[model samples]
Target: MVKIKANYVLAALWITLLCSCQKRSPEIPEIRQVDVLIVGGGASGTMAAIQAARMGSSVLVAEETPWLGGMLTAAGVSAIDGNYKLQSGLWEEFRKNLYNHYGGPEGVKTGWVSNVLFEPEVGDSILKYMAGLEDGIELMLNSTLGHIEKTQKGWIADIAYQTDTIRVETQVVIDGTELGDVAALVGIPYEIGMDSRHLSNEKIAPETANDIVQDLTYVAILKDYGKGTDMTITKPEGYDPSPFYCTCAGRCNQDSIGRKLWDCEHMMGYGRLPGDKYMINWPIFGNDFYLNVIEMAPHERKQAYEQAKWYTMCYVYYLQDALGFRHLGIADDVFPTADGLPFIPYHRESRRIDGIVRFDLNDLARPFAQTNALYRTGVAVGDYPVDHHHAAYPQSEALPDLHFYPVPSYALPLGTLIPKSVSNFIVAEKSISVTNLVNGTTRLQPVCLLIGQAAGALAALAVDEGVSPADVPVRKVQQALLDSKAYILPYLDVSPTSSSFSAIQKTGATGILRGEGKNIGWENQTLFYPDSLVSKSALQTGLQDIAAGLVITSKKETLTVNEALKVIYDLMKLRPGDTHFSSREAMDEKAKEIWKNHMDTLMDPEVSITRAMFSVLLGELIDPFSNWPVDHHGTYRSGIN
Candidate 1:
């Protein structure tokens, strides 16, 4: 009996040891090394990742939210604000995908405020699909940046991804966060809220600066469920309908006569999305909430966002109970949250970094006439008017009338993406170096996309060339963007589809040929009249900067083919080449040979040369832009200066 009991004890101890060995230990955090580390998976961050990956660099995107499209998708601001006609780069690709999904452009034009409107989930899915197609991108959803340390070789960042912390070592770090959090973490200098007139040098700017940013909105997607469905949500805490009474049925000063200018139906139809839904992001006495949570802690920000969400819920209640639209409720199938609200609030402004160059109102109003020629270093373009939302502020009435400041379509300089103090860093989204006034326009959807794309290209080029972002040649970055079908010059007339697009772009960058910019109502323009005849004085003005001794002997106003050949001969003298013709006849003979080899049509020496023809010839022959390198301030470093 004692021997059997001892055997039983031995068997029990062995079983216990086996059970202890089978138990799992705590998981260790992973350490990932990548060429480019994008901090946020927002609009610009996602574009930056895709662009960097497409440029043959391994990229990792850390997005706090599960979705990618920040304002366009997660924030539920589905209606595109601008860039309806200026679809370039990834923005054009994303828009085309949207058109494909919705059947056509006509299918998504369900809103009166914008030409394009779709469900937020659809935008998120499209972005995910676009990002997924790139093999070089690795996306970490539900990830938040923890600690960032700049090393001698690159940057090391600790990102809280899902249930574990991930250490990422990258050569380039892109701050694509909605609020520029990564830049702030690295102790980079940035500006918040308004800039004084003395600082910004805008005639309309206020004398004193303040911490007053644009009102952010927590957009909610409401769907129409039938008249008798009773889709109205439960009354929110501290719900009051009195504040929003004036939103739909009230007499305002804008109306010359004392009359109700707006109705509930018209207000709802303003943001009506496809498939019988509403965006619920109205501005005037609507859901635009006043809060600056940029400096708040994570928990503090969440608490603040809850207040904004409740305020939006209050407005929704007002829409249903007071306005008699009881059938419209929060769209249950839109978001992954327990509540039907968007994943994040629509932030209209962010901490603007102090970059190598500061893009201001003057840059937009008169791009070509700037002191530094900032237009020559453009990487992204925007045409939206300076639209600000400050109705929620008490001193909003004292602010300058931004609507009076009309600006032509302008290109954002590449220097705006490179921080002056930080190395190997690029800022995208709304955090670029632009004045508060310019941010109102650059903060739009399409411009942010292009800006993100440019940031990606700059980061990728810096990694591939083994140089800092600031050290990368501005022309090289611009050329890469052009190759990606992006606009370095905001020329409305000449598009990426044009055969002479690259040539015109290169020539325009060199200031050898300039476009005329105009501000017509809401549609700003920079027209490059490709078919117009090249004038002698215009050519002389353009060539004076590159070719110092070139003189136009032709007495006619418009330059002919013979005169153009002589000018090309003079230009050839400045650049080193074997085809340095001794006389106009010899130059013409060489030009004919070159034209036959390059261009399709026969060379005619009698016909007047058009702007397009001259640009193509200059691109093929001299390629002057390659020789001239512009500095951070857009000043030419070598020839022109």
Candidate 2:
């Protein structure tokens, strides 16, 4: 009878296979091209779309997930751990929207860097709002890229989603995907393992080399009500067979009780919830996915997630099931994924481009003024210490909370983002050009956004100009970013000034332009440093200071006496123009003659400024043409992206 049943089972299996083979072909959607195509809709992709849209380019952002904001919203991780220099453009606008809607930073007087605590939904609302605020930005969610091919036109992205198969054409593409999938698809050369050596040379890395990277965390935000409920999760299948927790006393930094408190007992994470007391996205529970999370078969993927889920569920069960802890519950409902895990894996590494330029710790430690190309391309500012983390390393042990040299202002290179062969595609996550080990330094969210802003602005400009991203002039892009108020360069200009003064003096004082006097390094509490490059906005204040001083009596120029007299007469009669002489066309001929006369007539020999006398001389030189390109006062204006 058993043998007969086996024969029947084989017959049934063959019939199932036969039926599956008879399935019809799916109706694929027609392909469409775009000026700019972004692969992911995370923080970087969202910002890129904003840039392209503002530049008046038709752009499409494709995301596999349901929402936007990669680590910020999707991953349910809080706190933008990064340099303080993150505020401008889409980034600034994002913050403003958050502040306006949530009243977080908007209520504060100064919000250069406010640690605004909020739920993931807020981030979701804000990103969606930004995408809507701009035109020409199409966000295609649930879209998956099947394959990418480069043709004579540019590149073609073959995508499949839900019940449709479509193709997208674009001049430029951005690989904002979390895993660097676009780079891999486009054949970008990149490194995967940790550097056998330190970031630069053999300075600080471990002697031996390894390929396995740092651990990933599945984060979620849970609230408590101070009263126990049925919010506990049960142990997953194959829980006991898992070897993914910190086991060694040395590694875990726990004797026995600590381990029991977290592992065996699990009574640690419960906080005053319901009352909204604490937010949990801690490192208390770590899953062992590297050892067990692989998908050899379609069904295995579910098994993998189940294991991870069990790890998390068992974590809470240790609190509720084993410890009978009160007021403790899992917030898994807040971020449930298709596999019932957190929306994101908190990945530490994906794909790093091996393109034009590669950044290493050596670049940071490369002794300033000792490098080129890389040093010249700084678009943002950062001073955070190099931070790296891995699971195999004893993360549970009492760490020194190590910190390395503080990098002031350094340029993040273009090569790091662009793939070697793909001209249009760029990356702006922790998965840029770096050995997996170096990702430790670049993974910080703020740094990621800094990279994102630059990539976004560049892609936007490329879309607007109908050119390859490689062809866009970096300087013009820099200027546009500067105009948008994004922090693209070093923060060397921050002082008082006004449009009524020449930007030359204000900027010269701050530092960018070379000056006659030495860089006295501003120890004098009374004197404004002449070498410092003051912000363009400050020029207005500087002009006001100058206008207030009595030095306005002006016996200025030591030019040809007759020329000076003519200049004085012209100045007395010429109050009717911008830039001192109509900067518009039709008046170009007149402007040219006036410019020549002005240059020849007023060659002031000596320019002087006191904390007091400084203002008057500045004003006299400014108000003449303060509304020009550099502003009437000439102080360099700046904003952040």
Best lDDT goes to which candidate? 1
Write one digit per residue (lDDT tens) for candidate 2, span 247-302: 32223546552442244222232222222422333343334334222112325644
Report, for every candidate in turn, its global Cα lDDT versus the true structure: 0.85, 0.51
Tens-place lDDT per residue, model 1, 299-402, is 99999999899999999998888787899999988887988899999999999999999999988888767777888898998888899888777777788766
Worst lDDT window (10 residues) for model 2?
Answer: 517-526
Stretches of candidate 1 exceeding 4 Å from the true structure: 1-27, 249-253, 256-261, 576-590, 593-600, 639-641
Residue 150 of candidate 2: its Cα lDDT?
A: 84
